[model samples]
Target: MVFDIGIVSNKKILLVDDEEDIVNLLETVLRKEGFKNIIKAKNGIESIELCKREKPDLIVLDIMLPDIDGFLVCQEIRKFSTSPILFLSAKDEETDKILGLGIGGDDYVTKPFSPKEVAYRIKAYFRRHQIGSGKQTSYSIGNLSINEETGEVYKNRNHVILTAKEFQLLLMFCKNPNRILSKNLLYEAIWKEDYLSNENTVMVHIRHLREKIEDTPSKPKFIRTVRGLGYKLVTQENI
Candidate 1:
């Protein structure tokens, strides 16, 4: 059976790491996965400049770059683009992961991760972002409007800019309204893998998503936490 993998089928990827071996390995893996345009950068400065010049679809960045570090790199890139960023780091601490995600990163992978796993995560990101393509469906909750066909969200008639992951989370909530979606379920569905103790990862993304879509993120109405259970999107029918 043939399938159409939109958006990502011909994405240009930017791979940034100081280690040549890691870059080579990821390059090989992405190539085998059928990615055509892959660009490489060795240090933080080069990565930043290359990102501006190339404007790749996604970026795989290492945190321990020789110059400025991946966190700083992500901050810089966010100034110009909202391209999806996946951090590659040896820092596996929960704080590190939270900090990375807090700083506009779409995802993070600790060091010693399977190259295949990284490839899969990237593919999942692309898949979720492409879910709305070729569809004219729109969903509304309160004052917010989501146009799936154009991949756009609006609050009070103003456009809301969201990272790719945030948009995906919102879409998921729209599709499964009134159901308590556990963190593990969300992680697996969106990231295409089993949850690996990344609960805080989901929290960070959810918080960000709420901030964009809610009148008051601190007292969110659209996305409500079920405490011990998980989260659910409460539309007008449930309200």
Candidate 2:
């Protein structure tokens, strides 16, 4: 996919991996793809420090690092920044994928991946952010309010912090209220990938979103499961 080079060049990208060769290869590819402001970190501690200092627009992280694993690094980073994190790891286990996404990762690309594909994914994420930013709409359902322009969410006038993916999920529901969103549809839409019958990814994110926005996640009032159908965000009128 061709990206607007002028826009892409300005976004700062952080590449974190203990392997020197992997980091170099990714940096080369990203630079070739018009990403100019690339930062490199070889370990989890350095990655964390750079993340705090640089405040990158996105991060490509590897799970197995020298100081701490990528999962812990991701947890720490999520406490402050909502920048998109793409996990690049050799661990292809389903549990690891779930854990990565559950802890606040936006995408997971296993090792032995194509550099061009990774570059394309990064471009796609930036494109999504651009499109999302162009929106100035705000919606309020019950006590929850979302400002798409600022990417801010509020619950009962109290500020609610959300991961980037979680906020996108809520925004998707808010856009299509009272409509059933099947797991496959949601997986395709939010993950920006084909649905591989991996329902857990969507389920985990939805559970997390409920925890943040619902009065009682156990008996969710807004995002309700339609059992065999899928899930729906119940509007105020429906409630």
Best prediction by lDDT: 2
Most TM-score-accurate candidate: 2
lDDT of 2 by residue, 1-239 (tens): 34466889999999999889988999999999999999999999999999999999999999999889999999999888888899999978999999999988989999899999999999988877775336589999999999988889999999887888999999999999999999999988888889987899999999988988999999998999999989999986542
* lDDT: worst 10-residue window of model 1: 1-10
TM-score of 2: 0.93
**Alpha-carbon lDDT, every model:** 0.85, 0.91
TM-score of 1: 0.82
Model 1, runs deviating above 4 Å: 1-9, 113-116, 127-133, 237-239
The residue pairs found clashing in candidate 2 are none
In model 1, what are the clashing residue pairs, if there are any? Answer: none
C-alpha-based local distance difference test score of model 2: 0.91
Q: Per-residue lDDT of 75-144 in model 1, one digit per residue for the tens?
A: 8987677789999989778899899887789888998999999998888677655643365888998898
Give the C-alpha miss distance for residue 155 in model 1, angstroms. Answer: 2.2
